[model samples]
Target chain A: MRATVLYAAGDVRIEEVPDPVLHEPTDAIVRVVRSCICGSDLWPYRHMKPDPHGRRMGHEFIGVVTETGADVGRPAVGDVVVAPFMYCDNTCEFCREGLHTSCRRGGGWGIGGVDGGQGEAVRAPLAEGTLVTLPVGADDPLIPSLLTLSDVFCTGHHAAVCARVRAGSAVAVVGDGAVGLCGVLAARRLGAEQIVLLGHHKERTDLGREFGATDVVTERGGEAVARVRELTGGDGVHSVLECVGLVDAFETSLAITRPGGAVARVGVPQYEQVPLGRAVFMANITVSGGVAPARAYIEELLPDVLEGRLEPGRVFDRTVDLDGVPGGYAAMNERRALKVMIVP
Target chain B: MRATVLYAAGDVRIEEVPDPVLHEPTDAIVRVVRSCICGSDLWPYRHMKPDPHGRRMGHEFIGVVTETGADVGRPAVGDVVVAPFMYCDNTCEFCREGLHTSCRRGGGWGIGGVDGGQGEAVRAPLAEGTLVTLPVGADDPLIPSLLTLSDVFCTGHHAAVCARVRAGSAVAVVGDGAVGLCGVLAARRLGAEQIVLLGHHKERTDLGREFGATDVVTERGGEAVARVRELTGGDGVHSVLECVGLVDAFETSLAITRPGGAVARVGVPQYEQVPLGRAVFMANITVSGGVAPARAYIEELLPDVLEGRLEPGRVFDRTVDLDGVPGGYAAMNERRALKVMIVP
Candidate 1:
């Protein structure tokens, strides 16, 4: 089997790797139908220190079950499935509570000692609980969009849900990445009255508008806050979707939020400290949101995607064959493509 | 008129000050009948640098309206009224939104140029908006309880409300000060079933129990978090009222809150930054709370206070004449009294 491997920063290659097999009673073997590079993947792609044995790459994928272990009942052989960003036992207390991201008995794919998703064949743990069937053929053109349910799309949906976005809500999305653009769509589907997209890129902002952004602010920092306020009649927004983890994004999200409002963030914060005491208290603001419990939300949002009510697959602006994975990384790193889908 | 003035770390004196006069269309003059020494007052009482012109010393008071400007209505001259901890124009956009603490046209008393509540006669700014009538005489024993509406009781209530305390919720009140004690009562009034009071002081803890504490954790820091966890069947509380803004208190509050729960804080935070991003995100916890909007809450709670259903006035453990305020401060600093009620 061939898989994308990262030996060091700026060093990505598609190389022959041992094919994955069902290794445990709860494991299943999946034949990768679609995969994609994530924005977070860039962090290590640009800065990871050298490692002797190359590391596994990619955690987002949708595929078909080729084989399953004895204990796995669901996701039978030949079934098309979506693997959430991580694998978790659905019976855990945390999973039962709908916080699969914090699942007590779960682990990340392609991270730690697990196999990566950007390969011809991969092993999925907790197969019965983690795999969601698509009820369609894997060769469908909508595969790219369905693959997104593995991570980014579900993440954006989590951000919207946590922000309490609904009819009568005024929301501001603070990022232009694929996830942020999806957030605009999620907010729109939730019936938000006004959606403000904060980004400078024409390509991204245009998509954001189509996704349901009623306004766009090209400026950053304090100026961006001012623009959001101006757009909302000086009252700011009832909800803010912070999809970037940068400190400045966090600050802007908090600044543009009205009193008694919420700032639901899905970004992994980069700062060691958030000076939110006085500001949060004085305005009666609720500072919440966190890592998207993608698995918990996959089933709930799957219906919308399958019905063609949402087309998040548009976020994949380009596609690459298995061997062209390197160029895909280059294009995304150089900002030439919003996201690149991988067809093996 | 006489006023309690802080001239230095240890110099508190009853000094003659000019009588107050209404200087604004919305102003009124109130003859103070009662005032209270707050825990925050000690911040300067024990640390302020020496100065020739003493600083004003109080922000909690219940008084009789002796005069009103032509524009003022509602509470006529001679009516007993309670002044909120701060003055805010009820008509501002912030106030109209029920966030009076962040009112655009208001300022706090006893800070900067505003008159202090400890004075014999106070020129109340935004009088019509800041004062709530008691519908009773000053001679009523319930005067001490109504005086709490000016700050402590209302502040505690704000903490409960912000923490989203509702029926069947388990709550933890952090801090053993007057505000924290009141928080226990507020949580009970809001329908919390299991209230955990975190404080070691026997005197204060006793009052906390009377106010509705079902459990008491006499530890601080890490140990305190363990205690709270053990008390809640290791699942943590549904809500946390952080009445102490110290870093340890903040950390303990977050540590003891369950995922998707809220922590409502009221005390002024005593730290530069709170590294809350990762902790808050992973658990889906919310950190909110700040200065209480006392004026906005007084009316909703007045019936309870006036009917003797809530006796938060009992938090004032001692009383002293204007000249003996210095002794009152000494007793509180020495831990001889939980709080002191000032008879002006």
Candidate 2:
């Protein structure tokens, strides 16, 4: 089977890898139907150290179940399904609490000898617990939107949920990546009355406006903070979604948040330390959000996609096959595409 | 009027100062009946730089209204009232959102020429907004508990509230000071089923248990984290009240929080930076809470204190008159007193 592999910085290739097979009674073999490149994947693509064996890539995918182990109770063979970035046993205490990402038996895809999502097939551990069955067929037109449930849309929803975005909420979304754009959509769906998108990209910000951003601030750094504050009547917005994990983005998120408001960070933080100094302390601001528990949110967001109320699939501007995976990485890394979808 | 003043670290004096008078149309002069030395006061007492004019000390008090400016509509002359540590115009947008600490027009007591609580009288700014009138008299037996509503108890309640403590929650408190003790009570009041308190002081831990700690772990650092995780079935607590603001305490709070848990910090963080590294990000831990908005909580907690359902003032183990305030500061600074009550 052909799959994506990272050999070193800026080095991605589609290589033949051994096919995955069910390794545990709780496992199932999933033939990948659709997968995509993620912004997070760019981290290693930019500066990953060289390795002889190489690392499998991708953590998001929607596929059809091809085989199941003896203990697999659901996701019968041939069922169309989507897998969250992490696999987990649904009955764990954390899973029961709707924190599947923290499940004791959970593990991420593409690392520690597991199958990567950007491949022809994946051996999904804890199949019944990890895969959410999709009602549509594998080739359904809604697949693009439904594919987002694997990580992107659910992550944006996580940011809004963590920030407690409500119908009357005023929100500021920082970053213009696919996740940030989805966050604009999530904030709108959650009824945020006012949203300011802080991004310099005209094309992406335009999409952000379509997703319910009432205002756009193209400034960066202190100027961006000033613009956001100006847009929200000098008090800043009630909630801030930090979709960029850079320290600068985090600082801007904190600076533009109103007193007593929340800053939910969905981006994987690039720095080790965060300032929780006198300013943040005195304003009574809250900092929350981490890796989204996509499995927990998929059920709630699926119906919206099926009903045509949400069109998160618009994030995908380019598409590729297994052979074009390497170019897909370059296109996204160079900002030529907002997001690239892969039809395996 | 005599007031507590800090000339330098370890140098406190009760000196005669000009009597406070109404300064703003919204101001009122309150005759001090009860004021207390807070844990935060020790911050300045330990290392304050000498000044030609000493800084005023103290920020918690209950007093009787002596005089009011034309615009002061409530707490008429002779009415007993409690003032939050910071004075805020309760009508401000921040105040209306139940975040009076962030009120646009709010300012802290004992700073910028404002009269300190440990004085004969205070010119309470935003009088109609800052003072919560008590139904009882100055000499009421509930005065001690009522005085707590001014700061200590409300600060603890803020920690619990920010952590989202609810019925059957497993909570851990990381300090045994007045605020942490009050946090135990708050957690109990909120119906947390399992409360683990981390403190080494037997006397304070005893009070913490009385306040509703289901278990006590006296270890520090790694041992403390292990003990807490062991107590909660190796998963840690769902909510952690970080009443100590040191980086070590904050780190422990993060370490012992269960995945997807919250750490509410009410302490004045002594450090400038906090680590939000991969460990915290992957666990989906939330770090929230800040300076308590006492005015917003006073009304909700007053009824409970009035009915003897809470006895937060038990934290005060010593009393001092105006002249003895200097000694009161020493006792608390030396750890000879849990908290000190002042009568002017």
Candidate 3:
């Protein structure tokens, strides 16, 4: 099976690797149908994070199950499915409390502690917890949206949920990438009457408007906060979704959220000092959310996608063949594409 | 008028100062029947904050309206009153949202912001919003408890309310001073089933126990979190009240709160760098509370104190006459007294 592997910085390659097989009774082997580049992958790709020996690429994917272990009950072979970026048992106390990302024993894919999904075929651990059966046929054109459900859509929803977005509330979304763009959609779905998207790029801002962003703040950092405050009658937005892990994005998120409002941060935090004391007491803001427990929002958000009530697939500005995986990574890295979808 | 004046750190003197007159149409003059030293006051007395420069001392006081300002309504002259340490116009939007401490007009008393108590006659700003009339006679023996309603008691209730403490919730309180001790009582009133008081002194622990602390963890920092987690079946407590404005206490408060729980921080933040990125997000904890909007909770908490349903005054271990106010500041500053009440 051909899979994307990283040797070092700027050394992504599509190489033939051994096909994955069901090693546990709760595992399943899926033929990757569609996969995409994630913003988090840039950490290792850009050497911002240490590059381990023989690292596999990608975590977001929609696939067709090729084979299921004996213990698998729900997802049948040849069934189309969209798997959340991380797998969880879905029954632990943490998972029961909607913290599936922190599941005690459910670490599964793409993360350093888990396996990767950018391959012709991949082994999924805890099949019951990892896979969500898709209603679309294997050849359906809705694959891109289903592919987004694997991460971006659900992550955006989780970010909005963590921020407690509600009807008639104002929301500010940091990061104009797919997840942040989807955040605009999520906040709208949750009844946010006003949405502000902080984006430097015109295309992304346009897409954000399509996703229900009523205002676009092109500035960043303190200036961005000032712009948001100007839009919100100087009180700042009622909720803010921080989708960029950069220090400026985090600070901007905190700065733009009104006092007593929640700043839901879904960005994979890079090394940075978060001023919790000032934000906690001085601003009286609530800070929480990371590694969005996408599984928690999947069941709730999937219906909207399936019913065409949402078009999160707009995030996939570019699509490529399986052979173009390396190019997809390069394109996303260069900011030439919002996201890259690979059709296997 | 006799008042306690601080010319310098540790240099308090009971001097004859001029009687306070109405400074604005919104200000009233109150005769201080009873006023107490607060933990926050010690910060200035010990030079932890800026050195005192010819200012009055106390902020917590229960008094009688000797004179009324032109705009003052509700409280007539000679009415027994319990005003919060800070004054706020209750008609403001921020006040309506229950954040009276952050009222738009910069409403706060003592610490050189406005004329403080600790005098025979103190000028009260936003008089109608600041003063709460007591139903009992001015000579009621409940003066000590009612005096607490001016700050610590309601500050403690604000901590619990901000933390969202509810019936059967497990609560951990950091800082065993008067405010923290009162926090235990506040948690009990909120119906917390398991209350842990982190204290080093036996007297404070005894008071904490009397105020409904089910357990006492004298250990500080990481060890304190361990003990709290041990007591809470390894998951940590559902709510935490942090009343010590120090690095260790703040960190401990964050450490002991369960994932998805709240940490109500009422301590005046003295530290600059509050690192709260990965660990905070990973824990899903929400930090709330500030200067403990005492004005917001006084109406609800004051009646219980007057009826003897709550006894927050037990925290006052020492009492002094107006002429002995200078010695009272020294005792509390030297750590020989938890709190001191000055009767004029």
Residues A1-344 of candidate 1: C-alpha lDDT, one tens digit per residue: 99989999999989998888767999999999899999878877988799879899988998899999999999899999999888899888778878777677788888766788887878999999898988889899778788889989988888899888989799999999999999998999899999999998899999998888999999988788888999998978989999888888988998999887888888877666776866676777777788777888887888888899998989999989898899999899988999999988
True contacts kept of each: 0.68, 0.84, 0.50
- Please report how far candidate 1 places residue A88 from its true position, in Å: 3.0
What is candidate 3's CAPRI-style docking category based on DockQ? medium
For residues B203-299, what per-residue lDDT tens digits would candidate 2 score against the true structure? 9999999999999999999999999999999989999999988999999999999999999999898999999877898888988999999999999
Candidate 1: segments with Cα more than 4 A from true spot:
A13-18, A23-25, A53-55, A69-73, A232-235, B7-11, B47-54, B111-113
Model 3 misplaced regions, further than 4 Å? A48-52, A111-114, A277-280, B48-53, B111-113
Give me the displacement of residue A285 in model 3, in angstroms: 2.3
The docking category that best describes candidate 2 is high
DockQ, in order, for the candidates? Answer: 0.59, 0.86, 0.53
Instruction: Compose the digit string of candidate 1's lDDT tens values, residues B246-339.
Output: 8788888999998778888888876757877676787888777888999889998899998999999999999999988999999888879888
Task: For model 3 chain B, give the 10-residue run with minimal summed lDDT.
Answer: B106-115
Best by lDDT: 2
Clash number for each model: 0, 0, 1
Residue B258 accuracy (lDDT) in model 1: 82
- Between candidates 2 and 3, the DockQ winner: 2
TM agreement with the true structure for every prediction: 0.92, 0.98, 0.94
Predicted structure 1, TM vs. truth? 0.92
Residue B117 in candidate 2 has what lDDT?
Answer: 98
Q: Which TM-score value belongs to model 2?
A: 0.98
lDDT of 2: 0.94
